[model samples]
Every structure is written in structure tokens, then in C-alpha cells.
Target: MGHGTNLLRRGPRTAVAAVAVGALATAGLTLGPATAARAAISCEVTYTGYQWGSGSGGFTASIAVKNTGDPVTGWTLTFTFPGSQRLTQGWSAQWTQTGARVTATSPAWGGPVGAGSSFFLGFNGTWTGSNPPPTDFAINGVPCTVNQVPNPSPSATPVTTPSATPSPPPLRIVISPKSIVVPEGGTAGVQVTLSQRPPGNVIVGTGRVAGDTDLTASAPVTFTPENWDVPQTITVTAAQDGDATDGSATFDSRSSQITGSSAVLWTAVERDDDIVP
Candidate 1:
């Protein structure tokens, strides 16, 4: 009986030690064969496009991104156009195009995507010659499985249909070179343009919305119906400061004349001139 009791006490100690070892392994002690790593990012994407007119035509592309891996707080979708596709407008995301590559980043109101969930983004673009859809896509820098949807076949017999009234494009302020770095005590310029022609002459104002007070913007600029599409330069000047740390500011373009027009924000960073002590 005494020997049995001793064995039972030793059994508890062994079990406790085993549990301790398991805890350490769970904490990444690597006691055994390496644990399989979970992929940080994985996705599946669907792409579809619709075009109207010919030669220089306009297209609208829709993309659905399904998360197959972990949850993501934010996402950036990237692709390369096979043809000469140019982005004109986008929704649900911020879109930019450079050469053949295109990028779409999550907007402020966009929400996160959980594992096994999906989100949608799209844009309006212009193309010439051929309007071939992109074959590849990546989300958050990881390659995604792409599923391309074929364009619908035209009807053999033409049928007359009533045309609905076309809606006007949303008013927007377009700023070129949305970001810049202003040298301390120097100036940098950014061009501002209107997304669409205004009803009449529009006066756009530039002002600092937030951040360092040392950064200043030029006076208001006017955009007329004749030159609404043309870019108007807005000069940003950084005041010299004694601090050695780089300062940053947010500048916004606004207009009181254009109702429902959204303001555009741009960032400016002041280069530090003073050396750290």
C-alpha cells in the first residue's frame, strides 16, 4: 500500500510536468516537429468589366475580394492592365494608376474583412483599342486567385427600349500630387482641378486643416468653365522653425460655390533643417 501511494504521488508530478511542457510548446518553445505556420494573407478575387462606345470607350470594372486566410483591418488591391486602361473615377476605395499598374486602397469608411468573408470595389475607366481585363491581382501584397467574368453577349435581334434620364456626375475636387514635402523655409506647389465642369465660375480656397502651424498655403484660386479641367497650382510654404523634428500638416481644397462638392485633402511634410542637439 505504501509503494502504491508513492507511485500515485509521482504520477501527479509527471502529469503536471507534462502540462508545463505543453504550455511552453504552445508558447513557441519548438519542442517537437515544427508547427505548420498559418498564412498571414490569402485571397480570391473576381473581376468583371462593361464598356460602352468604341475606339476611345469608357468602362466600369467590378472586383470582389474574398478573404481565404486571416482577418484584415485594411487592404490594398493591386493589378496590372494588359491594355491601355486609364482610371477616371472609382468608388468604395481610393484608386490610382501609374503606367500599367493600378492600386486601390480602402477608404476611411470601409470596414475590415474577416476570414471567409468578402468585399467589393470598383472603378470607371477609359480604354483605347482593346479593353482586355486584368489577369492578375494581389491583396495586401499577396497574390490572389483571380476569377474573370466574361462580358455578356449582345442580343442577335435589336429591341427598342426606353432610355432613362442620366444622372450627373458627383462634384469632386481633384488635386494632383496629393502629397508633397516642403523644405523648411521653402515652397512646394500642387495643382488642383475639378472632376467635372461646374455650372459657372468656381472659387476654390486652400487652407490648413490640421497639424503644424508653420506650414501655410497660398490664396484662393478660381476655376472657370473654360479651365475647370486644367490644373491650377497652389503653393505651400513651410516657415522656418527652431525644432529639429520634421513637421507635418494637412491642407484641404474647398469651395463655397459648388454645393455637394467634396473637399480634397493633401499632406505636406516640412523637412527638418536644424540638426538634433
Candidate 2:
């Protein structure tokens, strides 16, 4: 699904360049009334903004269409999504998704998007949890007044009990300077490692530490997994001055062996799979 094509050909005005390429090659898809009197000459469409792709599991967006109305012959776009973010595969156009709605259409070589021109279409999804992305959206069916960019919150607060007593498995932690390229106020020294299996004291908590916007640390240090299975290391010393972006460091576990941190600031309520990554 790599359909990202952009073609804009404007050479009209020589007596309406052969009636605008024969009215954009039979522009008929049932818009009757002779395409509404040829769209009353003066089209307009715009929506420029969107492109995302990340993983802890799933996310993909890529929308961006423009026309500013007036030279169109075809086009239609729609958007929607809130909870179960669906919509999986899409490209140059022609797509549909029910539940958390989505729609796109623009083939026939993108009919006629003159008057300024711009195009893009993308889709791919899966996000059954952590909701936040619906400040109201729309396009083609109008609305999309702009808004959709918010995903960060999962520092710590995930551990619920149901009963049956069987919990202990989730500590993949890995830090070894994974990122601390200091300089904005310089000062770095991180070394956190822990796989799984061993238990009996392993606490390291501060919540968030991705770029250390002005780094500063003193939390994290308590290990003992050198025989109960193997995998352990602890070293902390962070200190940045401010602003540069890209910081991370979080840990919490003093027994019960269950840690977390891959890039989820805060938002978890139940998840205990036996740890092993």
C-alpha cells in the first residue's frame, strides 16, 4: 500500500484548453445536472495536515488533500475515529471503514484537482486502548476544522487484581543510555537493565525520563537477579539543563518482579503476562 502519487497539470486558457481536457474526461459519476452546471466554476477544497506511524503496537494516519475548489471533477474524503481506531489498508484513494468511520475516493487519475492542487491518502490502524483523538474531524463531508494530535500519558498506574492469586511476570526494562545524548545543559550517565525471572527487591521509580528536558535524576537502584534466572544491571545518573526533547527512564518493583517502560507515559490498569522480552 504505497499509493502516494501527486500529479498537477495546468495548461488551460488557450480557449479553455479543449474544454478543459474534454470536461476532465467524461466527468460523470452521477452528479447530474451536467455535473451541477460544471460545479459553477470556482471550486475549493483544503485539509493539509497529517502523517503518523509509531509502534508499541499500531498507528498510521497520513491524510492531506488540497484543491481549493474550482477545477474539480471528482473527490471525496471523510474522517472519524475515537475508541477502537479501526481502518487498516489504503493508498491512492478508494477506501472505507465502519466504526470509527473513514472514507476516501479519488481515482480516474485524481480527476481534476487544479486551482492549487495537492493530494495524499493513507490508512492503517489498531488501537484498542488508550483513547484520545477526536477533537472533531471531517472532510469532503466538511467539518475537520483541524485537531488530532495527542498521545502521551502512561507514566505508571497499571496493576489491578481480580483474584485467583497468580501474579508475577513483567520486567523487560532496558536503558543503558538508550538515549541521553546530552548537550543542552549537558550531563548524562544511565545504565538500567533487567530482563525477568529473578525477584527480591528491584525498585527504580521517578515516572518519566525520555529526554530529561533539563535532566535530573536520583531514583533507580535496587537489584538482585544474578541467579534466579539471570539478567540484571542498575546505574543511574541523569542531569540535563532543559529543552532538546527525547528523554525516558522509569521503573518500579521491589519484589513481585514486574516492571514496565517502552514509551508509555501513563495509562494502564491490567496487564500481567509472565514477563519475558
Candidate 3:
């Protein structure tokens, strides 16, 4: 179990800095507070999931935490699985589970997340009955606003923007079942679509961001204005490894034409088939 650390502890200004400010005031100059006030820790978290099989099944969960307030030297995210989702393996953080509760602590090389920056962590789990996304999320004991990304339906219509500009909605690439389980010698697919229609032909590029090098995603797929609303599938294949442990990888999808639209992240877990009884 890893614990988060914050070197910037809250306290009073140093005496030497205060004395220098006092001298400056006597010289006809004013100085502000020696230490800047620390902003409250606030965050926005997005939870996305993808599942396969029936009855007792396996799924992947991807969580994105955006530091909306102050910079976090490190962070600990805690949440509960609405269903009987037991963690099998995770990446990008130190993961632990106690019954239904799950905790993810920042890794040694994954910390010091700055304000306005976001970090991603996910896991492969098993679930029973129905799988529902968790509504409660907290970072460093502070509650976070959770945004759930819903799966896009096949009959979904294209969103039309008005000619007269009002406040434009946040642009995003829609990826359904944002996570997948790829067997060590097999592949999995995820759908990619645009939240709104593009002006012309838009190219959707896919690439691996982090995780196991043995897992590879498909090449870039293009979606034109004529079929922007239709979902396109991206394939992820896992290469066989000698180890028996499952491997995970993160892939990103971005639209070449949609300005200000951030890349959407998805995770792939390799189901190692080399384990013996």
C-alpha cells in the first residue's frame, strides 16, 4: 500500500522573509504575503467502464482525475464498485481493495500532478449481475464531481451546432466501452465516434499512451462528415508473454479536425493464458 505525500505543508511564512519584507516597507515599498495561499483541493473525475461475457463477467474501469484546484504532490483516490466487481489487476497507481471499497495511490514516478492537469488510472475486474458505475469519488479525502461517460447507442443522431454562436459545448471524442480485455493471443474492439458532427472529413488517430508494450492498438481510422455519427471500432491485440500475470495498456483517441477536443483514453488488459493449475 502506497501513501501520498505533500511536501508543501501549510504553515506560517519564514521569519527571515518577513524581516526582509519589513525592511522593504520602510524603504517606501510594500511586499505581499511571503507565502501564497494554498487553494483548496478540488477535482473532477470521469468514470468509464466496459464489460464482456455473461453472468459472472470481466470488465475494465478507467478513471480520469482532473485537478481543478491546487497542485497535488501526490493523490489517493477512493471509490466503491456498485456491483460485485473484484479487482484483478491495475496500472498507473498502487491499487488495493477491501470488500467493495477500492483505493488507488499515486505511484512513485506518477506524482506531483499540477493544477488543471489530469491523470488516469484503471483496472481489470470481475463482476456479477449488473455492473453499474460508482457515483461517489474522492481524492485526498475531498469529494470530487463525478462525470459518467455513457455508451453511445447505434441510432444516436448527430448533434448540430447553431450558426449563431452561443457558449459552445465542450468538445470530446466519444469512445464506447472505453476499456477492453484482449487475450494474450487475441484482440478486442472498441467503438469510436464524434460527439458532434465535423465540418469535413475528420481523421481519428489511435496510439498507445502507456502500459505494457506487448499490447498494441489498431492504426488511425477516418470518419467523414457523412458518417460522423456512426461508431467506428478500433482493434487492440495483445501479444503473448512468458509471464503468467495479466498486462494492461492505455490507448488514446483524438480527432484531427475537432479543435480543442482532448484525446479520449481507453485501457486494454491482456488475459494471460499461460497460467497452469
Candidate 4:
């Protein structure tokens, strides 16, 4: 009886040992892949200089994405602008604007971003109001701090008194081909040439024959008119034109004049005209 009892105890102990070993093996199998996955994925993005366009009067910032982690099938970038700077255009990714915040996502390309591989995206928009770029930015939800770029100093000082020799107006403006014809509800392209370069903070106003219209650019103070109702002569004016420090005079206008379907005759008013035309 004693021997039988001892044999039964030994059998159960052996069974328990086997079960413990099996559980450890299963745990090792489960953890190994997870560790490997983490090692394989990379998440680093590099920022290059922006490629500015002529519309919306703002700069387009470019960035490169390098996958350092396990192959990334997808990712997202979120950033905020300091002050009133806003994002108006983007490519290679979908963008959403909320207040001063902007977020971009990679949805078009789903193929794995293999380890060490990279991709690129850019954002374009108007600065509208005066403000600086935000210091904080993010990649794939990771926090990043931007290096602040120094602001350029103002070049021209206000003229205290009219010189005996009056200086020519800071900017000379000309409308190219002087005219255009576009279908009603369509857009007309107008080219403006400037005798002088424009200031960094320069603002250009659009004048049309009818209806309210707004123009924008990706480069500074340049734009294309979008909404038109009828045909009419349009005059565009530049304000706060800059001098040689920023660039040379003789800058071309990206957005100066636009006409509608119905031509409205515009005559320049002269000092001699008793009645303004």
C-alpha cells in the first residue's frame, strides 16, 4: 500500500513539472515576436527647407520621414502655429486645420515604409497676421522642438521729409497685356510687375468690378483671384514695398488685376480733371 501511494505521488509531481515547462515555453514564444517588432520599427522624421509657391502668400515647409522602427504601414504628424500663422495648403498627405493647430496623416501610401526608408510631405498657407512660427512640433505623436529662425531687420527707414528730389514711389506697378477675358463665374489671370521688391510683411489688396473677392498666395504677398461674377476692369495695389536689403526692386506681381465677363471701363483720374472719372 505504501509503495502504491508513493508511486501515485511521483506521477502527479512529474505531470506538474511538464506543465510548468510547457507554460514557460509558451511565454517565451509570445514575448519574442513583440520584442522583435519593436526592434524593427523606426520613427524619425527630418525637416528640410520649405518650397514656397506663388499663391496664398505663405511658405511651404518640407519634411522627410525615415522609418527607424519596424516597418511603418502608416503614421501621422501634428503641429501648431504660434500667433496667427495658419496652414492653407498641403500635399502627399491629408491635412486638417483646427484653430491654430494642424495635423497631417499618411493615407495615400500604405505600403510598408521599410526600415531606413523615407518619405516627404509639405505644407503651404498664408501668414495673414504677424506672428512667429511655433517652437513645438510633433512626428507620429512624438514631441519635437523647432529651431527659431532669426527675423530679418527692416531695410528702409521712413522718410522724415520730402527730399528736394522726391524719390520715385517705392514700387512701380504695371498690369500685363493690360487685359483678360474669362467666362462668367470663371477666373481671369492677371500679371503684375513691380519696379521695386516688396517688404517681408507687404500686403496686396485686390480690386474687382463687382462682388466681394479675396486672393491668396503661397509666396509672400502674391496671389491669384478665385471668384468672379461679371466682366470688369480690376486694379490691384501694393502697399509697404521693400527695398534692396530683402532683394532688388523690380519684383513681379503674382496677383495684381483680374477681369470678369462684362468689361467695365476704367479711366485713370488725373489732377487736372475737375470731376473725378
Candidate 5:
């Protein structure tokens, strides 16, 4: 029967070129750019081309597929473009070439990538003449490390103990109530706790939370954590000072390198020496 219909159409076109790699994430941020530390699961690829004539042109390739090990579930990558790039179309997964060897797999929702996480596969190609870029890449078959964006190594024995970059996760500014009780001149407000939202202004440091004498704040405190999303108030006002015998004062909100937590405002002297006839 015509050789079994050409072996069932070449066995599903060689299993659709055979290539698959599901989503992977974890590896602690850092994906698609600026990366280092080899082994454990690595792969990188980036290609871009544009011509639009004579044989047509238009290319875009992005394959990261990293992991560092463990937590796979599904993945497969194989590359070979050297030149004549011709992928046609692609989205998140399912892609297959034939001549220049290209195959990516992962469909039906496509997902899975943890253990230092990494999973990126973009594609869009259609070339005819020249469209270099795609020297090497692999996932299921190993091989993949691309991502070298660091130059300055004359190598004359230069190693001045400077190769440790990974420190940015310690900024907590919490300043809520802590203690408040006002009813003399009346007025109490102290709130400051921004989780994440600050690319500019952050100057907080009021006064009066020191030696108890009835609150009185609103000093150089100007925290604009971009909008903080919510909870952003700092107002403490209480001053009666006739003394019927109820006294308490404290106002202290300090923040040097993103760390503010100190609030206390209590005052209840009542009437302020008066007789509301």
C-alpha cells in the first residue's frame, strides 16, 4: 500500500521534528539575560534577522530553558541553523523544521520548570538568503551556556577578590500603631509599611516619640513609595499641657537604610483646664 503510506507520512513528520521543553522557573530570578554559573541545567539562544526581500527574511529566536537540575517533567531542545534560517511561525511551543534541524515541543498548555527555574522559547522565522545567528543550542541533548556579557579580563593575573554579586533583598520599613492613645488635643496617625514600591523618594524621620510629653510629629517625613498602594499616613498632634494629671508623649520615626519602626503617641489631659459651662 505504497509502503504503508510512506510510513504514515514519515512517522508524523519525524515526530514533528522532535523537540520539547516545558516551562521551568525557580533558579532564583535572572532569566533570559545577564546570567552565569554554568552546569546543573543550562541553555541559551537568541537570534534576530530582518531582510524582507529577495528571498524574504524575518527571524526571531529565543530559547533559554534553564534549570540547574531537578524538577523537569518535560523538555527537549535541539538546534541547528548556522544559516538559511526558516522557521515560519511559532508561539510558546510546538515547532519543527527539517533541513537546518530545528525542533521544539511543548503544547497542551505547556508548563513545568522549577529548580532555579527557566523556560523561554520564542520563535518566528522565514528567511531565504542570509540570516545568521544560531551557532549551537541543545536541551534534551545537553549543551547550552550562551550568555556571556562580561568583558575585562586581560588575564595578567587579575583577580582582586571581586566576584560576588547577588545581594538585594533586605528592605523592610514597618511603622504602624505600635502604641497610640490620644484625647487631649486629639489627633493620632502613624502608618508606614511598604512591601515593594520605591524607586525614588523615601525620607522618613518625624519627632516627639522620644521622652513622652504628648505627641507632636509631622517633620521631615516624606515617604512616597511610588504610592505604597495603601497605608501611608504620618500625623501625630496632641498638645494640651494644662495638666489635670494625664501626660504621655513620644514621637520617634527613624529610617536610615530602609528600616523604620518606632511609634508611640498617648495623651489624655482632658478639658485643658476648663469648665464647659
Candidate 6:
């Protein structure tokens, strides 16, 4: 997964160097600290506001929408006028004004903003006395960072970003028949399953219980798993002594080559096997 952040794409910044100082006021967008998210779909807007003299006849505002995290399909720009500024006309997109709130939607041609790319639009507005640029901006229902002008000129260095990568699922093992009882002279079969294919060959090992005088166990002490899809069966034969009253012996079946080596250790109740069991 890519972080979607890379070399900053420069079109036209919000800062107006050509306009005489004091004659125009910048949008003064706020570039707050980056927010943490499960998937960073961060977006940002850079605005340039030109005030006509004393903001008596309203002003003209241009906005460039940028995708800082992931790619976006379309944009629905929304903002609120701080003062009595009312939108008069807009170009490059269709806009709707509701009281002091305004919304702009992308036109038929442009709206898809790829990661690290941006688009811009401008609108004219009217004011009674005071005209102030909007402090908040959201695109497509997700709030975007309001980036203020760094200075008259943007930084020359390109921002380096790290790509995102997802983690793989963990390895698992399953076995059937946690415990068992063998007849006087009978045998039982147990199934061994793997969660997924092993990184390499896997081996199974069996250990005999101590002081098992009346019971004898016969099981495929060692095994080489053929594949992940197929399950391996281990036959366990036991010898029952009539002289002894139900003598019991226990055995362990474990994978020779497993992840974390000693992470999984399972004990069968009667004659059990496998990871889950």
C-alpha cells in the first residue's frame, strides 16, 4: 500500500505575489498536523483570495484541491462564508449557495484527482462590508487539510513518502480427536491438517509416555506432509493387558518444522494429534 505522498505537485499556489501587499488578503488556510487513519485518504485545499480594495465590492477566491493520500473519484467542495460574503458567480464548476454555506461540484470533464495531483477553480462574490475567506474546507464528505501559504514561494525540496504494505495471514494447524480409548488390542486413526503450505518441508514427531506398562502405542512416529490441501492420517495401535485394569499410555504428535519453533505445543486427551487438537 502506498502512502500516496510524494514529490509535491506545484500548479498555482494560493499566495499572490503579483498583487500589491495590503490590497489583497490571502485565504490564510490552516495546515494542521497530519491526522492518523486506518487508510490515509487525506486531502488538502490551497486557496487564494483577492480583495477588491476594501472588500466593499466583495472579492475573488481561487481554490486548488489536492489529494494527499489516496486517489479520489470526484470532489464536492463545501465551505462557509465567515462574514456577509455571498457568492455571485463561479467558473469551471457548478456551485450552490445556501444561506452562508456554499458547495461546488466538479464539471463533466474534470474531477478525478489522482494521488499527489490537484485541480483548481475560482469564484466571484459580493459583500455588504466585511469579506473573509472560509476557514474550513471538505472534499467528498471527508475533511481535508487547509494548507496555508508557506511564504511567497513554496519549498524547492520534494517531500519523500513511504509506501504502505499489508501483512500476511498467520500460519495455523488443526487436528481431530483430542483424546481416545483403544480396545484390548485395537488401533485408531487421527487426522493432521495444516493451516497453509509450509515455507518448506514439515516433519511430525511422536513421544511415548513413561511408565506405560499395560498400554502400547503404534503410530506413524515421523511424517512428511505431502501438501496443504490433503490431510495425513496416523494409525495408533494399542495393546491391552487383561491382567491390568485399563492401563493407559499417552503419546504426543508434533510438527518438526513449524513457525516460531516452540510456539505451538498440543496434547491429545486420549490419543490426540494436530495443532488445534
Off by over 4 Å in 5: 1-162, 166-185, 195-210, 213-229, 232-248, 252-277
Q: Candidate 6: misplaced stretches above 4 Å?
A: 1-40, 149-277
TM-scores, all candidates, are 0.43, 0.19, 0.43, 0.37, 0.20, 0.39
Best-fitting candidate, measured by lDDT?
1
lDDT of 3 at 56: 67
Better of 1 and 4 by TM-score: 1
For 1-277, candidate 2 gives per-residue lDDT tens digits of 2332222223334547788767866565445555645543332233332323333235566666555555666766766676766667788888888777777777768767776576677766666544345444444565544533444323223446587977766665555544343333344455555656445655544344343333344455556666433433332334432333444444332333453443323211111122234
Candidates ranked by TM-score: 1, 3, 6, 4, 5, 2
Q: lDDT tens string, model 6, 180-275?
A: 565556666567666676676666655555435444434433333457647776555655443434445565666647655423332332322221
Q: For candidate 1, report its TM-score.
A: 0.43
Clashing pairs in 6: 1-164, 179-270, 180-270, 180-271
Which lDDT tens digits does candidate 3 get at residues 145-209?
Answer: 99998724222235576778686676568998988999999999999887776778888888899
Q: Each model's RMSD to truth, in Å?
A: 32.9, 28.8, 34.4, 28.2, 26.1, 23.9
Question: Which residue window of length 10 is worst by lDDT in model 4?
Answer: 242-251
Off by over 4 Å in 4: 1-29, 32-42, 48-56, 144-277
Q: Go through the candidates in order and give each one's C-alpha lDDT.
A: 0.87, 0.50, 0.83, 0.49, 0.61, 0.63
Measured with C-alpha atoms, the lDDT of residue 26 in candidate 5 is 35
Error of 3 at 138 (Å): 0.5
- Considering lDDT, where higher is better, how would the candidates rank from best to worst? 1, 3, 6, 5, 2, 4
lDDT of 4 by residue, 82-142 (tens): 7666777888889998998888888676566777787778776666444355555566666
Model 1 regions lying over 4 Å from their true place: 1-39, 153-277
C-alpha-based local distance difference test score of model 2: 0.50
Model 2 error, position 118 (Å): 24
